[model samples]
Target: MAGTRVPTLQPSFDELSEPLRETTFVVVDLETTGGSARTERITEIGAVKVRGGQVLGEFATLVDPGRSIPPNITILTGITNAMVVGAPRIDSVLPSFLEFSRNCVLVAHNAGFDMGFLRAACQRLGLPWPAPRVIDTVRLARSALSKDEAPSVRLGALAPLLGATVRPDHRALTDARATVDVLHALFERLGAVGVQSMDELVHAQRRVSTAQRRKRHLAQGLPAAPGVYLFRGAKDEVLYVGTSKNLRQRVRSYFGRSEQRRRIRHMVTLAERVDHVVCAHSLEAQVREQRLIAAHQPRYNRRSKQPHRGWWVVLTSEAFPRLSVVPAQSPQLGRTANPLGPFWSRAAALEAVDALHSAVRIRRCTQRIRRHDPDGTACALAELGKCGAPCAGLESVTDYAAHVMQVTGMVAGSNDDVLTGLHQRVVQLGSAGRFDDAATARDRLAALASVLHRGQRLAALCGIAELVAARPDGSGGWEFSVIRHGRLAGAGVARRGVAPMPIVHLLQASAETVRPAAGPLPAASAEETSTILAWLDQPGTRLVSSTQPWSLPARAAGRWQPFVDAAAVARGSLSGADLRRHAVTG
Candidate 1:
């Protein structure tokens, strides 16, 4: 007797005990009109509510699917049209079913099929889904039973193996009742493996890999707030970066069943630690995520922005200025010349420059011509009546100064000259019935406007040394942003009943000092500045303080359109119709 071995059912100190006895489960089954939840409708609903091995209640209903049941479905379910003639529609019966299973974990043989129909019904009726926790006995049986123990985890095959009293016959209540027995038997087998806690029982569904289950402890210290998180490898290099409104929950889910991406699963396997930065708001979290991805260039983060790689349309400071596309860091830009863009591509910058040439003549030639002393040969544009031919001495230096002033004004935040010049060409082409040519000119107008619009806005923000803006956070709190030279230098929140000005001053003092770089986009990447633009553009945002005037130009392109006749009359630029043809210059 001293040498004999005895197995005890009770757990020792470290093992969690008696989780099934404390939890409630609502086993559910549905017979629908067809296989697809989107096109089909539910014909019957059956649910058995239980807790601690006792039957708490039973919910059974005949749902009128609002359509005739298909012959195949009726034959399978044995619920004919005449049988459900007096049944209540799903809209009328859903409220009672929802109340019956409120707060209980849903159990089913194949839960996706059952849950999809229920979710579709809720969406159709404009009802909010409680989105309760679910357990599938099929997954549980596969995890708990060997192939020899149960040949199949289907309800009919599992009923006899698990000693279920009810025989499943494709009917709702019978299948749900059989699933209840299958669920409990699987739980008993899991108990032998020391999985007794509610969390462990949910984990035994086997959708979660064992490697991921072991790594859950890494998420324990993360805060439940809006933030950016970085997953670091064993060597302390960031492997992946992400942002979430609830940092703890989002990170913890990587170790749970729903996260099944092969790449993310591998990321979890290699992940040794998680680091987080809590943010004042969702926008701040998003901005920080972009900055982090830009900084680390983590292998798993897609399309990370490489700062200072953007192209710009620059005007040269030579004897004869010409439009050229160059990168933001190019030294071709001079102190007297302001660049037109930080365009995404050289081709895009060239297109915008072509549109500018079509509007006002910035000579297309690369040759440097001195005033009143050059070869009088004309280029192609000069022959096409497009250029003033300053290189050939046909146009004087005094005459070229007018075009220079127009371009300088346009570069200094006005689009009237370009808009007017492009408009006359578009109208003449259209009046000549050359619609395709007009369309091409109009497209040029759009491209120029798109790039210059963003360029102006970003330049205005970059010109500012410091700016503070606040917006309501929808919870009696104020979300504040401190920007320096177009970068999100600092962000914070002043909760209810607190004065925001002091916080604004504090954030301003502690914010990052961003120096204006040589190029047009002085600080921050285009993506980062664009993110800040989106936040400041949101409704209810109010400017708290600023060092420079944060404004667009009076003749900025947004309010102007290329309607020569209508605009000339409305703006009174032309004195009379007699001079309308000569009023706007090419």
Candidate 2:
């Protein structure tokens, strides 16, 4: 028994672990009459089918393009019109070639040229194009071999380096056979990157910088869990901040074979180190990423960097209050008119203030006035009854204070009396044929309404001192987060059958102790407020606890349709008239 030889079972190439070894590749080449597929036609076609380095079949045909072959093309390809006089036309030969290459991955050197001619032929005949997965051997060879090793990627230049059995001579069949050999050689080189599947091979053809390849080690230690990653440069400054459900995969993708944005590739090359902070779930990772980006203002991050640059609408504190658009840097404080803001821009904030003035009898003058100063003169706004005229004592302090209270109530989302008065004025102006005045009043009302709605939403979010909410984590479990006065404080996870008390307690202990800002409004940054609002609005998020009362009105004050419609029409007509005038002058 010891001397007896057992049958040695050898593994077949088809049974190898690599998917490319089992894939059928059809290498195609075409001799065309001109450079562009739109104006040219294929004079000849050739294809070679192979698998596991073995040729399965070969196909070659001369196609009559129904046109004279150019002298330049005949000289370059050594194919003459006399050679294809009796040949079958491309329409007759296309069906057979497509049938021969069916269910196979197509391969061509500079694939766009060959594939374009083939597709153009199909389009001309109104035939359904056989959409096959394609690979460009030129790109693959470029990624696999250095320029020093192969100075040119052309089929003629690469054939010798790849040990092609047949040298390309501009004939279609010879070039196709040489391409098959080059493809196999490139496949052998792709093994260095562990490209075992067809999909990976396709992705591996992208040109990857040597620096990017070397820094792939930075991603080796990352955990495959939800977290935020920071890419740091040589000076230890954060270059980019990103969050992902699978940290390792996302980090590794930066070094993968697919081509990335030029800016991202530049950043990756500059990155010296990668650090990460683990989170309980994806939601926490997203919130943390936004916060970090806002805090660091990283060069590679484009969003959430300048939340403080937004504008705010404030009613300046005075004997007679007047709305003003102020920068977010100088927010209104306690007992000094209420602040409603984080408007996208100063223009929007000014529009809101203008709208408010059109609705209420607030002074618009920038001059500081002492109450009941006899020397102070009333402005034209007062003469027009747009202001209470406290500068000239035309309106009593009690009456002016009442009007200020009305404006404050509207900002607080509690009263719509001013809105009602504006609506009546618009109706009266329209009845008297004063359409311009009516449209102006309507514009003001709309602007006021937009700011009121924005303020109400932000205030409601800030009103809650401590909020606990839960949502499905999409893994048969629950994700919980704690928000403290519009800032994400802590987060945790609870499994399906386990008691959530421990997780809840742990989150509360780790939660940041953020003292609520003094005032009826929240003092958090615009980015923070928006993040919390978006999380709370997600479907299936349950509010477990809260300390302050919060609710939005069922209907907003800006719902008046008549004024809104008239304003829209007036603006459109004005714009149309301007366009016509410009046209005539030009």
Candidate 3:
């Protein structure tokens, strides 16, 4: 399709700014046989070369996927075997594509997915993937769109909602054109936030990457318990708020050793310190997390806490007016007489209500009597016995109130009686020949069970806590701990007075790896940083005491010497945030 009759109505590249139009952006899209990276293959590739804000040329070709396209995928992308027949394989076309993209940035709607696919294809071809930088219009839209705009963030949702007036053909070129329009509109809108060059965009993306990395790392050591965690940066300012169970465990996960550990390592390098609060239960933790995340507006967490913009579960006043989830910012929240969730998403709210109905058999439909006044009949749910048909006047107000009480009970994580009844129903279904019904009942029972099982469990060894410290001896030797509850947890199997402490200390010290900070902290002085590194490079030392874990005494100078020396000699490289701030200032 490169040289065919191009659409005349398409906007010319000259309409864009000199820099943007001359950027040689490869406006690209890929048609995959399925969604999964592990299981799917790309069937078509499409790109249009834009320069001087005009489409200089176009490129598109189907590929023999070497496997049957799933029927659903065929329907979605309209690409079939016949379309790709005799078409060049990815290997035949990728080389030329790479050459074309050389020195030019890539552009895509969901660029991550596309880049992943491209990387996979390159790997299959036994070629080193040149990961040229990419610009994602999807990211741009989220950053650029105002809060008052429609509650749509998807590509198809964006065009009409953004007032772009572009055709929604789902073809590659058309999609690319629409994206260009969106980018143009955003640039026009991004007055102060406008990026002057491609490098600036790259810098912004790195910040995002760093934030995501930190979140994932902190999540690593999270225990199954409920608690709250904080994300702090330089000057001890909290950058984000989160709640989790098992504080140490959750914080540890953020620093998990993996290729994707960008945020964890970056943040750790930048962080001056950390703080946390343990919660008694998961709900308490969640509520606290939400409040804090909303209050702090952390850089890393998803922007879910806009004022009056969260989601809500609305119970309508009319007969059979079904419970539905809509934005809290919407007028729908005000109209509903009864509602359950101001949940983060409509899906989350619906899931909550569904669990309530499944557990307590609460009628989600509105009152039958009220429906008649509104000139509507019972909904399908009420007619099908899924609802109690309050709209039909079959259930009294007292009865309806009882159902509402049951739902409230479910949401509050209380009402063991209702949960017991639900469990009994599941047991009965399983004992009978209704296996399918039993399975569904069992799932619902599990959901309800989790809500009730939110509180903390006392550790059996809670009576005693131990602190252990380790320091490198200038040679290959290390010294370590055996402290317990502000004292030694126990005496070790050491010969004579030494006790068997060294071995235990080493094991404990190795288990507790420090996580990197998420943002920049003031850089350690050259001497201090070097000393720290030197200490780290030396043989491990263990600190042991017979006291509570938190009561372990700080290590003395002799023990700290190795680290001190390392810090003195080690380089004090600029942290991720430091670099960004510096670049901006410069």
Best by lDDT: 1
**Candidate 3 residue-wise lDDT, 1-586, digit = tens:** 0000111122222222234534777878778887776678888777867765676777777788888888888787777778878888888888877876777788888898888888898998899988787988777666556446746767788877666656546566677677766666665643234333454344333323333334443443334444678778887777656666456544544433322455445655565445665543333355456556667776666643553354555555543344566765566554543334334456655665676566554566433455333334567776666776665566656666776666445434344456556657756765665655655555444433432221100110122344444453233333333322211121112223333345555444543232222111112111222222233235553434435432211221122233333322321443444432222110
Write down the lDDT that model 1 would get: 0.78
Q: How close is each model in CA RMSD to the real structure?
A: 11.0, 9.2, 26.1
Clashing pairs in 1: none
Better of 1 and 2 by lDDT: 1
| Error of model 1, residue 208, in angstroms | 6.1
After TM-score superposition, the amount by which residue 52's alpha carbon in candidate 3 deviates from its true location, in angstroms, is: 3.6
Q: Output the better candidate (2/3) by lDDT.
A: 2
Backbone clash pairs in model 1 (N, Cα, C under 3 Å; residues 3+ apart or in different chains), count: 0
State the displacement of the C-alpha of residue 56, model 1, in Å, after optimal TM-score superposition.
4.7
Writing each residue's lDDT as its tens digit, candidate 2 over 238-357 gives 999999977876776787577478888889999999999878776678778877888888899888787656777777877666778777766364344457666888888887777677
Off by over 4 Å in 1: 1-26, 30-45, 50-56, 61-107, 111-151, 157-174, 181-214, 255-266, 334-336, 560-586
Q: Point out the worst 10-residue segment of candidate 1 by lDDT.
A: 1-10
Quote each prediction's TM-score: 0.74, 0.76, 0.34
